[model samples]
Target chain A: MQSIIAVSELSKVYASGFQALKSIDLDIRPGEIFALLGPNGAGKTTLISIICGIVNASTGGVTVAGHDIRRDYRVTRAMIGLVPQELTTDAFESVWNTVSFSRGLFGKPANPRYIEKVLKTLSLWDKKDDRIMTLSGGMKRRVLIAKALSHEPRILFLDEPTAGVDVELRQAMWEVVRSLRDSGVTIILTTHYIEEAEDMADRIGVINNGELILVEDKNELMRKLGRKQLTLQLHDPLDTIPDKLSAYGLELAAGGVELIYTYDTQGEPTGITALLGELQQAGIRFKDLNTTQRSLQEIFVSLVKKPA
Target chain B: MNFYAIRAIYLFEMARTGRTLLQSVVSPVISTCLYFVVFGGAIGSRITAIDGVTYGAFIVPGLIMLSLLMQSITNASFGIYFPKFTGTIYELLSAPVSYVEIVLGYVGASATKSLILSFIILATAGLFVPLQIAHPLWMLLFLVLTAVTFSLFGFIIGLWADGFEKLQIIPLLIITPLAFLGGTFYSIEMLPPVWQTVTLFNPLVYLISGFRWSFYESSDVGVGVSLAMATLFLATCLVVVWWIFRTGYRLKT
Candidate 1:
């Protein structure tokens, strides 16, 4: 299938001499939730900003649904919806007006029914007549989402949609995202929340210092790059790691009451049995042990820690 | 830009500005009343009428337009500047709105406001000053054009303002003083030759002159010269605002 969103060799150099995006090429498929994960100042917002036409790109080109973002911005922008991180709405404006105005901004014909559907989908129907400033933070976020969806865009960009929102609201937002994807909307959300991406994203892309490090299927990214951990609860508290434990790279924790050993999950041998035998021989005994596969959060941290 | 969308944005902006309706109604009334008392009553008592018009009558045109100019610019500038201050411009920018739509919507709403308030002040002026309207249609025409010109100038100010401080600086420091010196409460012909010439540089003089010309059947300053200056001021404001929008100055990175 042709990529729904294609960015070729994209780069951004800010006026303040910061190179935000560094010649990064990326493609996003239709009907999938693609999460762009990165650290602070990692070009996540800059990349999204450029694609949304909020910021101009220094080099390279972006095409959405086959329409160029630069040369044919109106159609490309019409096809895309961007929910920015800020909760900036007309403070005195009713929720309905805010969302409707957003649709009108896209040159869409007035369709009250369509607007109502969007508000109901985001659970903003009840507050449609209420002023924006009076709504709670999460409700305001829902309004932002409603506004983005007002234009019925095929591609939606959520820039940290769940930031500063409560867990319940986050879960609510994820449900909305899932339904949107089910309805064939392509989603690209940039976030530091790995669990959100882990739970929702079909594919994950890691960006650091304006360069994309890797983009892979969720399961493949975990299985290929994830590292497992063997955490042993010590039967006896000790001052230091035993000499024999050095080879295993064991880290003493909580005054030696627990030990953590990290190993690559993709390695041919996990070597847990050999490590236990060595620990027994070294006079270290644990009543219980637990093994864990790498989480998306850990994978994200390690990926960003790597050199740009 | 589509008219429906522009109206939507315009109505949305007007609603936001409606919160200041009290301020909008009160500020001009208070200022006009004070000017009427101080300049019209106190100063007029000291000097006789000019061109057989009372001091109260002389200030009617200038006072009404002053309210129009101040309110139009303040409202437009604040409307745009507050969005940036509150970080709401990001939401606006991300929307599928064009620069022209943004300008027309904002400036249009402000122009509407100034027009409405201009009528209010003009009505209020009648209660205190026995001002004559030789041509009510002409008066309304001048009122409208004055409002439009100032509203456009205000739109440019909105784009030029970066912060709250920056927003108020031009209106407070520049526009206010120039309006004061632009023969708002008096005629430039009454001033010495050099002061009258100095007052000629203030573009507001032409705006006030155009407005005053409509009040009486005749005018001391030629109507053509005043209209030409008003047109020039309006054109300059349009070019500057269009340039700002096209360049995406401060709006885009």
Candidate 2:
């Protein structure tokens, strides 16, 4: 149950004076699917780049399983795998050679059986002998995954793993991730797809403007941040909210044909009962009534905006 | 760095420039034959020998060295630059390999290509004019040194370049012109005293002079000085490259 990856006060500043990461501190647990969500240029990729040893951090250090990434780089790097966002591969090389070569890069001994298994797991075995340039975009991506996993790393970093990929391939990738996780591989994924994280991540970390704003269990974050809205389809058109309805923060909607009431489910009382009673006293009646709950998508949008 | 990994990377790169085998092994032979036809066959009718050596034979070493130097720099520089421009460098950078492995693998392949081209050019030159190996050992040593030195130089150039065009600038504009002006087609001794002194300043002169001296017994430069100059040039290049790798100058950041 030790932290598989740790970052303390890490920051990255580019040569153009752009602050890519600012005072970030977080730790990822072993064998957990940790998804980092953020908008483009929000330092999610930068943070991953530093930990993957592809880019140098302007300040601070990161460690993988107690090995300092910069000082003990070989040991740290050997223990981790990174599938970069770019579709970069040896175009003229066969899928088999590319994955086998990648495994060799980690100083792993030749294991054709393992390479074949990785290719088959990614659905790339049939295309194993085909040149990389001839493969489709999704197939090439699968090859990158096979290459990343060929070395049998304990931790894997997939940066935007499903970008430009089809739904079927993405689902397949998710299954691969799940299997890897089941086998005790710690996964730190950065994705723009909120649903991908919402569906798969045990814990979610949201980063913005080079800062990590929040990290919490998926269910806990959703329950704590999610809000519900109560809607009333008024029987008669109301010109404005009544003075008595001021106690409840109800918003008139659809040109007075509907009223929407927002409240936290975690509150002592949602107050829908009291609001309905007050509406009756104020001569407010609805033809139909329903309530809708907020999702992680909404909470994410709100968190990205300035605190209000 | 794992040796097998380096070998794998080297073979992978060799495959990368697969098309270059045509250009490296074939193009140089064709180019040398053309040079022999126009410069050696036609020009030899009037000019006999520069200094007791046939004009065709005198320029043979220069022509071979010319292609070797140019091919070495272009092959190595373009080799690295294309991968960077094409975004394949990210795959390499993200791998669990070290920068040392990358350099050794790339430069090793480049050296192999340069040697291959150099020897082919030598054989092509033999078809036109005979070569006198006054000191076969020194000749072989000089060829190896020149190939390795320029290969390392080109590897650095490859890393420093940002674009495909940038990779060609040094060889097309600087190195080629320097080779011609350094008296690859002519002898410095024929020039006036001031021009001869000026030719000494060009680094290519030392390389070509050493190469030519190895073939001719009555050469002006000594073997020791030639080897020393070549060694110093190579050592300087290695140090700069090592420093760049250490700093990760334009690479990581």
Candidate 3:
């Protein structure tokens, strides 16, 4: 797939000597949902700001849709849409006017029909005539999304789009995002919610301490680091592991009423067959057994916890 | 040039002025009328006239300049500052519009507002005192040049100010006092020799002098020097604004 956005050796250092981002390089594939996951103050916003042209990068180069960000700002910016982290809208402006004005800012000719479609897609058509300040918080966020989509950008950046949103609204927003992506807009979102990334992202980038520590396909990252636990309810209690099954790494839990076995999914044969035979030979009968795979959240926590 | 983008921002700002009619339009007009009443009515009865023009007519240019300076700064500064305050500036900064286009939209709207106020004040002054324009074209030239110059200055202040209080500081403390002492109500020639020389150092004096000359053909300084000073101030403002956009000072992180 062709890269829609590219960043090479990007870095940002504020006047106060605080380095918000280190030398970083990234490429966003066309027609893909790329999720950038990070903890608080992890430079996710700084990275997004540079690409959106809201903040100047201290050093580096970025190109969007084959146009250099610095040299061809208008061209690059017109190809991108940004739903910023803040809910900033003109209080007195009607929703219709605000969205239409945003389209004009991109130097696009006025198209009321396109504007109407964008508003309707975000479910904000009913409130189009209402002043922005009168809308609910969720409705206001929808308006921001409508404005971002007004110019028919090829790439959209959602910076913590669901940070303060309620669960029902967040799900609704996710549906809207999915539909937008289905219509061919490449979406890049920065979020701390591992579940959100796991559910929606095709690929995930984990940023920590001004660095991107990992970037991989969502499924691959999970399968590579994911571990499984097999829990067995014992038919009878036991004091400890029997000598015959001492080779297997098994533990007694639930006060010896259960046996727990942990193993990597990628490990050799998972050791399940041999372990099961050993348990049977040792006369350790199981009443019930269940297996659970590690969630993406756990993998993320472990990745960020490793010392650089 | 992205004329569409410029028009979008310009219309948005002008729409804001309409929404705040009581504060933007009515307030300035009422305040200037009061200045005409107190100075042109009460003071005119005592002084009669200054430099052959009636007291009411003599101060007309100065009063217009005073309101122009204040309104231009206030309108432009607040026009940009409110977006910064509300955090909507990020949207604009990320838009495809260039810095020059953004400045043109904002400053253009602000200058238009000030010009409208000046004409309204001019009409109000006519109701109280007979008015004459020795150089009608020059009068308009001065009005437009001064409005555009101060509006640009206000754009700089808006970009530089980080707080609401900072927005009002320059117009209230520096520009207002300078206008008052810049011979708005009285000619600097009436001052002592030493004070007259000192008053010449105030830039507002040149603006008021050149503007008054356009109206009554009377000025504290030579008309050519006054026009030159106004142009110089305008050039300086343009340079500062250019630097702000280039360096992204207080605009980009």
**Using lDDT as the measure, which candidate wins?**
3
What DockQ class does candidate 2 belong to? medium
Every candidate's lDDT: 0.85, 0.85, 0.91
lDDT of 2 by residue, B103-157 (tens): 7888888888888778878887888887787877888888888888888889889
Per-residue accuracy of model 1 over A1-308 as CA lDDT, tens digit each:
99999999999998998999999999999999999999889999999998888898899999988889877777788888888887777777789988888888777878899999988888889999999989998999899899889889999999999988999889988999999999999999987688889999999999999999999999999888788888999999888877767888889887889899998878768778889899889888898888888889988888888765
Candidate 3, position B111, lDDT? 98
In model 3, the runs with Cα more than 4 Å from the true position are none
Preferred candidate (lDDT higher): 2 or 3 = 3
Which window of ten consecutive residues has the lowest lDDT sum in model 1 chain A? A84-93
Give a tens-digit lDDT track for model 2, residues A253-308: 89989999999989888798888888888788899989887877788889988662
- Put down candidate 1 lDDT per residue, B116-145, tens digits, no spaces: 888888888888889788878777777777
User: Higher lDDT: candidate 1 or 3?
Assistant: 3
At residue A196, give the lDDT of candidate 1.
89
**Candidate 1 residue spans exceeding 4 A from truth:** A228-291, B41-46, B135-138
Report the C-alpha lDDT of model 3 over A1-308, residue by residue, as the tens digit.
Answer: 66899989999998899888888888999889999988888899999999999999999999998899999999999999999888999988999999988998889889999998888778888899999999988888888999999999999999989877889989999998898899899999987678999999999998988998898999999889878899999999989988777766789999999898889889888889999988888788999999988888999999989998
- Return the number of clashes found in candidate 2: 0
For candidate 3, lDDT tens digit of each residue in B1-253?
9898999999998998999999988998899888888988887778857879999889999999999999999999999999999999988999988899998999999999999999998998899889998998888988998999999999999988999999999999999999999999999998999999999899999999999999999999999998899899899999999999999999898
Interface RMSD of 3: 0.8
Classify candidate 3 by CAPRI docking class: high
Question: What ranking of all candidate models by TM-score puts the best one first?
Answer: 3, 2, 1
